[model samples]
Target: KKKKKKKTMEMSLNLASSSTSNSVFLFNPILSGKQLAFPCRHQRIPKRVKPFCVKSSINLSGPRQTLSSNWDVSSFSVESLSQSSSRLPSFEELDITNMLLRQRIVFLGSQVDDMTADLVISQLLLLDAEDSERDITLFINSPGGSITAGMGIYDAMKQCKADVSTVCLGLAASMGAFLLASGSKGKRYCMPNSKVMIHQPLGTAGGKAMEMGIRIREMMYHKIKLNKIFSRITGKPESQIEGDTDRDNFLNPWEAKEYGLIDAVIDDGKPGLIAPIGDGSPPPKTKVWDLWKVEGTKKDNKNLPTEQSMIQNGYAAPE
Candidate 1:
């Protein structure tokens, strides 16, 4: 019965190809049965078998076109086909925000969950790898989420050799504010009306008494670490950061600058950090904070600070 079935399958394949030179053969006959057997007597038929597809191009009315003898069946695999389709997808049609990524800009507009943080971290790393001397602009408007995830992104930013310039759009709270402060010094900026809020890490403890206690301790450690990070970024005393972050400290752009959370408040007439390519002016110089070397890492060269007279305060130095 097996011999008859194999003969029938071979005849069918032969007839299929012989019917028309243009007809494409689209399947392998050997693996058509319930199980695939090998010629070796010791080899047994596997319980499962992978399907294969074979194709032959047909010439319709036009001139004959033949595939190269070097054509590889592996190239027509389902996985390869899917990957090719994915590569051809339109970014705009897919609604992927690749335009900013192309410009070395990463937007943290959503909560800093694992997915969001991973994407931002990857973009930062990729952009840095592309051009270590170029600045990576990070636009942030997030309420924040996941301290661990945010820390991962923060570490990635610091790990990059390129500088990161953070911009605050609408609001930056919790871990968002931490990231805003993590940008290269003298390069951080906030929209004129934007706000920044810094506070101790918030969390809920559950499960068991021991688990609750452990979680609380971990939160405390994170708070201390955050305070140190802010102190280092803002050039403020750790005590000040601790007190300020004890509760929700909301600061407007100017107040944020005063609090050392940002370097400047962007307004009209401000050149800001968005410089067109091929512009005669050189790219702004920035300082990258190295996680390994925390002290004396400030850059002496910085672009001229854009001045805006403070209405509330009589006179304030360039922030």
Candidate 2:
């Protein structure tokens, strides 16, 4: 009689394990075209003083094993791809969105530069609706960016159906930092390594000093508009908002919490139910401009912002 080959069942488990040094481990898999889109799932992570794993893997090959424990696993996830079907489910429909129970909040990081408003919106759209009901955490790590762009983000975060708790990772400076302080309703927090800043919008222009002087005047007017938004969210007075954003203030994580910038300093995951900031209000008004502003450039009257539904704001795309 031939000895039968031993059979074994295969399954992957995701555990939230942390180290005394604040090291974390995270593993997940994405399927594509009946194949793993990126076979090498191990992603090179940014080196932090605390060793932490992420959605991908990290390098543990240093001669000096700085980390107390090296986590390695072969089985991650085995998902099947459905082919032969006439049509398929779009990633937008099947993605993870509101995983409140899972404590898996999606942080768009900061749109300081390349991280544009559109990119963050698209990412949120990919989240599955089921996850929307779950507590959605935003792990913000940014130093603020465009004034107008930040407001666009503020509108998005302020209107989340999911429970959003923002935890600052690095520096939430300028417009980026202020938005977080105001946008989070229930649990606003920061890491020990985080910092916050509020200042006037600064930009470079191509013009003469005389023209530059006029530009500064226009920018200052817009400065008040930004201040109002920050003050409304932070519950601060316009007087205080203007003074802080006037290049006269910089706040570390400690100063941020003291000044109502953040709610708490959480070392790890927070467990509880948090009400959403607010429901979806009426659509924002469009900012129409003189077509003549662009020399001979025609405007698409049909594709105006007023016509576009709030769904197109990058939250969830219409099927």
What lDDT does the true structure give each of the candidates? 0.77, 0.57
User: Candidate 1, after superposition: displacement of residue 19 in Å?
Assistant: 20
Which 10-residue window in model 1 sums to the lowest lDDT?
A: 292-301
Model 1, 26-139: lDDT tens per residue?
444767554333222233456887889977666487754321222343565578778788544344423436556656788999999999998999889888887788899999
TM-score of 2: 0.48
Candidate 2 worst ten-residue window by lDDT: 7-16
Candidate 2 local lDDT, 1-319, one digit each (tens): 1232121111111111223234333324554332222122344577879767676455566554421123222211222234334445454334444222233456656465545776655444434244556555666777777766766666666566665667777867776676667545667877756677778888765588678778878788778888787677677899978755655366656567677877655533333233223332222333452234232232433344553465667654345
Clashing pairs in 1: none
Q: Which one is best on TM-score? A: 1
